[model samples]
Target: MGTIVVTGGTGTLGRHVTERLREAGREVRVVSRHSAPYAVDLRDGRGLDAALAGAGTVVHCATTPSGGDERAARRLIDAAGRAGVAHLVYISIVGVDRVPFGYYRTKLAVEGLVERSGLGWTILRTTQFHDLVLRVLQGAARLPLLLPVPAGVPDQPVEVREVAAHLAELALGEPAGRVPDMGGPEVRTLEDLAEAYLRASGRRRRVVRVPLVGASYRAFRAGGHLARDRAVGTGTFEDHLRRHFAPGARG
Candidate 1:
């Protein structure tokens, strides 16, 4: 098998992709600022070339936090094209085109870069992850009696593992352009999701749904961040919560 270079291989989803590729007995090269099994900084052209050398595929799971610049995506795309990488797989969020949020905008920009890079590429767009849901709820739970929910919105959150698996499959195959969008099986409100999380965690708390007044809220309320008709995840919020909150369970 040819070398598979996975950017951001240490991240939440990247780790799973790296493991899956490794389990398939493919030589894996990881790219990041920090040193690991392999290391390269996307911002540095020379480092990127060194990382892409002899690699047939590049799975890009790298992302900047909200409000950060998106130049990284352009840089990675340029490097992939210049290095003659055969396949470039990118992980993107669902509904990026409809959502006006800064992060989604950056994601859309990255998708465009990959599309026009001239390298064979695949884009896997997935919904919010189960861990993201928990993080939102848990952070809100820290505050007393106030759980801030996205007002009047529906979300179909999926498991990160499912997204990771789909991404790995794409990385191993020929580029299929934009693959099927993935999401959790059930549609849910943020309020209900938060309440479910609290109940699952054995917390007796009243949920106060706050009307988030902003572009973010408007986009979410319009379901601009969800996948329609392509929900393919096997785990539900309840299942995820049960596994997360189970006694002595380490996920």
Candidate 2:
């Protein structure tokens, strides 16, 4: 029932998490590069101590896909430890351990850091978010005549609001390390998702499947990133599309 700090509180998932926490009437501090009074960059530990001071829980949602997440997590752990924060909750991708992608590797490493940080910690791994899948499709749809997608790759895209609600629940409860993975209600192929996007956005493009070569691509094709058994999320990808393309839906 103390102040809770959310890193990257302005981001997609972080924003929802912050809203959920605030709805519960908990004191919430949003710490981010642009969050005034608590503008602390996670890349380094600068201004972190002040942000974490007297906070009971911290939801670590800040991550850099371009790299340097390990450094950021290390700095966060050290600061939380120094501030005597009770619980540290982290959001991670489901296949961090199975996928060989560089970003997944960094996420796995950050999970390890949280586990060994000697603090009350919890980690929730979920499948890809619907927004991320939409972004990929949108980028591919930008091509003149063809939308190229990874062949044989299936993604379970979960809703960010559901993940955020779960994270807020975890942040309020006692720390339970590495909880069960959360997945979307359905598993869909990239081609199918792309077609859906085209229909929703009213775009005309031929969807092409490209069998990309690489260990990471192979891992993705092999369903290493899926959580079929933990399909606890409620919203579907189509549901996301409707919301996304709705009139004045720009978030």
Candidate 3:
């Protein structure tokens, strides 16, 4: 294995991917706009060639959630192609093609770019993460009165560590275009996740189900973010809540 480059190496899942790659004794280089020594901005293409120069495989874990996911992906694809990287491994969300949500749409577009980029590539689609669900409810927990949540948006949240381990393995192997999707062991609604958070934290906030609006909600309701058949995760939502959020769990 040659030098392995990890984009967004400082971010949530990216951090785990980087750590796992390092743990596996791969020569790991992190690409990021700040902090990371390579300091490459995927959208801008600045420092990209230098960062990816000797990379045998480039693991793309970077995402611009506020927007620019497609653009950044395109930029990376172009740069990687130029750098002669052997394989491009991308971490994608499950149901990106089926979902009409903006982020998912962008992800689908990026997938197309990778397919046509004329480089060996592998895209690993995964379901939501446990931290994401907790973050949503944590934001709601700050509210004084009631905890507002989507009525029935179902989610299969997985552990970041598991997903990262999978990504690292993928990065080290031959490119397998659009690999099998991964998801959590348990499927739960947004409301259920929120209530669990509340209970774990010993908060008694009244639960309020608010009907979501727009095509995003429609896509969520269409089960666009689930991989029900592939429960690749070993941890449960309750296990995470109890370990990290439940009162005195650390003890």
RMSD of each: 1.8, 0.7, 2.1
Q: Relative to the unseen true structure, what is the C-alpha lDDT of residue 153 in candidate 2, on a scale of 0 to 100?
A: 96
**Candidate 3, 40-83: lDDT as tens digits:** 76777888888988789999999887888788888888888888
Q: What tens digits encode model 1's per-residue C-alpha lDDT throughout 1-251?
A: 57999888988899899999888888888887785545665655447877887888999987766533367777877777777789999999998998888788888988998898899999989999989889988988887767777668888999888888888888889989998889888889988998899889887667877777787779889888887688779899999899898889985
Clashes of each: 0, 0, 0
Clashing pairs in 1: none
| lDDT (C-alpha, whole model) for all candidates | 0.84, 0.95, 0.88
lDDT of 2 by residue, 1-251 (tens): 67999999999999999999999999999999889999998997789999999999999999889888899999999999999999999999999999999999999999999999999999999999999999988988889999999999999999999999999999999999999999999998999999999999999999999988999999999999999999999999999999999999985
* Model 2 bad stretches (over 4 Å): none
Please report how far candidate 1 places residue 7 from its true position, in Å: 0.8
What are the TM-scores, per candidate, against the unseen true structure?
0.93, 0.99, 0.94
Ranking by lDDT: 2, 3, 1
Best by TM-score: 2
**Which regions of candidate 1 fall more than 4 Å away from where they truly are?**
44-46, 66-69
Indicate the residue-level lDDT of 117 in model 2.
Answer: 98
lDDT of 3: 0.88
